[model samples]
Structures are given as structure tokens and as C-alpha cells.
Target: AQTVTQSQPEMSVQEAETVTLSCTYDTSESDYYLFWYKQPPSRQMILVIRQEAYKQQNATENRFSVNFQKAAKSFSLKISDSQLGDAAMYFCAYKTILAGGGADGLTFGKGTHLIIQP
Candidate 1:
């Protein structure tokens, strides 16, 4: 089975500094999607951003973005102008892109602990 890997267990950024979280995955399937989800102290898995396997352009959402290297199977998240609210546990997730994909369970990494410097 394909699996997501988060090499960095923890990361800290200044209130206005930018931080990048590392994420890597191994999958044989060609059609799939990669996602970055944030789990705050409340434990809600908020979808921060995502990328499609076929898209050449990286996915971005407001201050969040992804550096997706399809050939290397790497999908890292970059947060710009970090803030206290950005402190949380971030997870790397993967899922197939087709019918019944939802039926198959989603794969997630252990998650990276993000800290914000006041």
C-alpha cells in the first residue's frame, strides 16, 4: 500500500516568518491526489491545500502552498507570513482519484508539529 512520510517531526517559525514542512510519499498508482491537513489543538482536520497528480502547477491557498515534485513523489507545504494561529499539527495525506477511491481508506503521515514564535 502507498504511504505518506513526514520526515520533520517538529518545526517552529516566527510570527511573520515563513516555514516549509517536509512531506514525501511512495505510491505506484498514477492517478491520485496529495493533501496537507492542519489539526489544531481542537483536533479538527482542516484541509490546507492539495495537489493533483496531473497538474503541472503547484496548488496554493492564501498563505499556504505546495511544492509538488511528481517525479520524486514529494509534496511539501509552505506557509507564508506565519502566525500564532498557524501553530498546529500538519498531516500529509493521499488518496486515489477515481470512483471507489473514497471507499478505500485515506493514507496519512504521522504529522508534523508546527510551533509559532510569539
Candidate 2:
């Protein structure tokens, strides 16, 4: 079973600063996937970024980057030049199996509430 963990329950960043959210996972499989998702007050889960376990290089987006440590099973998300729009619930998610093949949806962490200061 693969499980994702987000250590910080809450975090805050200034309007134009940067913030990194910590995440770790436990997986026995060498080839799997990790993802970062953002859920706003609207409760919509949006994909922030994704990383394939086999890839040694990290994954990054416009304002997001990941520190993927395959050996340590850690994946952290860094939000740079943060904006008020980035203030939301950030979740670390892992894609794994279940009893059947329907578990491809996602297994998410408790989530970190990101607050942005004006």
C-alpha cells in the first residue's frame, strides 16, 4: 500500500513570497506516480503537478516545483512568487492500487491550508 503524508497542517506566505510544502510517501513499488493537488474553498481538486517515479529529474510548472527524492520516498511542492490566488488547501497525493483496478483516482494527504497575507 502506498500512502502520502503532508507534515504541515497549515502554512502561510506573503503575497509575493515563496512557500514550500512538505510531503513524503511510503511505497514498495519502484515505478509509480506522485502528485500535488490544490483544493480551493470551492472544493474542486486541481492538479498542481505530477512526477513519475522513474524520472530522476524533478517536475515543475509555472510557479511550482517538486523536490523528488525517490530513495527517501519524498516529494515536496514549492510555490514561487506566490500570489493570493495560490492560497488554498494543498495536498500531496499518490496513485496506487486497491482491491480492484478502480483506485486510479488518487490517495491524498490530510492537506495543508495555505494562507496568503495581503
- Prediction RMSDs, each to the true structure: 1.3, 2.2
Error of 2 at 106 (Å): 1.3
Per-residue CA lDDT of candidate 1, range 28-67, in tens? 9988889899999977789998798999899999999999
Q: Which candidate leads the pack in lDDT?
A: 1
For candidate 1, the TM-score is 0.94
lDDT of each: 0.92, 0.89
Candidate 2 Cα misplacement greater than 4 A, ranges: 97-102
Which pairs of residues clash in candidate 1, taking residues 3 or more apart in a chain or in different chains?
Answer: none
Model 2 C-alpha lDDT per residue in residues 71-116, reported as the tens digit of each score? 9888999999999999899999998644556747677899999999
The TM-scores of all predictions, comma-separated, are: 0.94, 0.92
Q: Give the count of colliding residue pairs in each prediction.
A: 0, 0
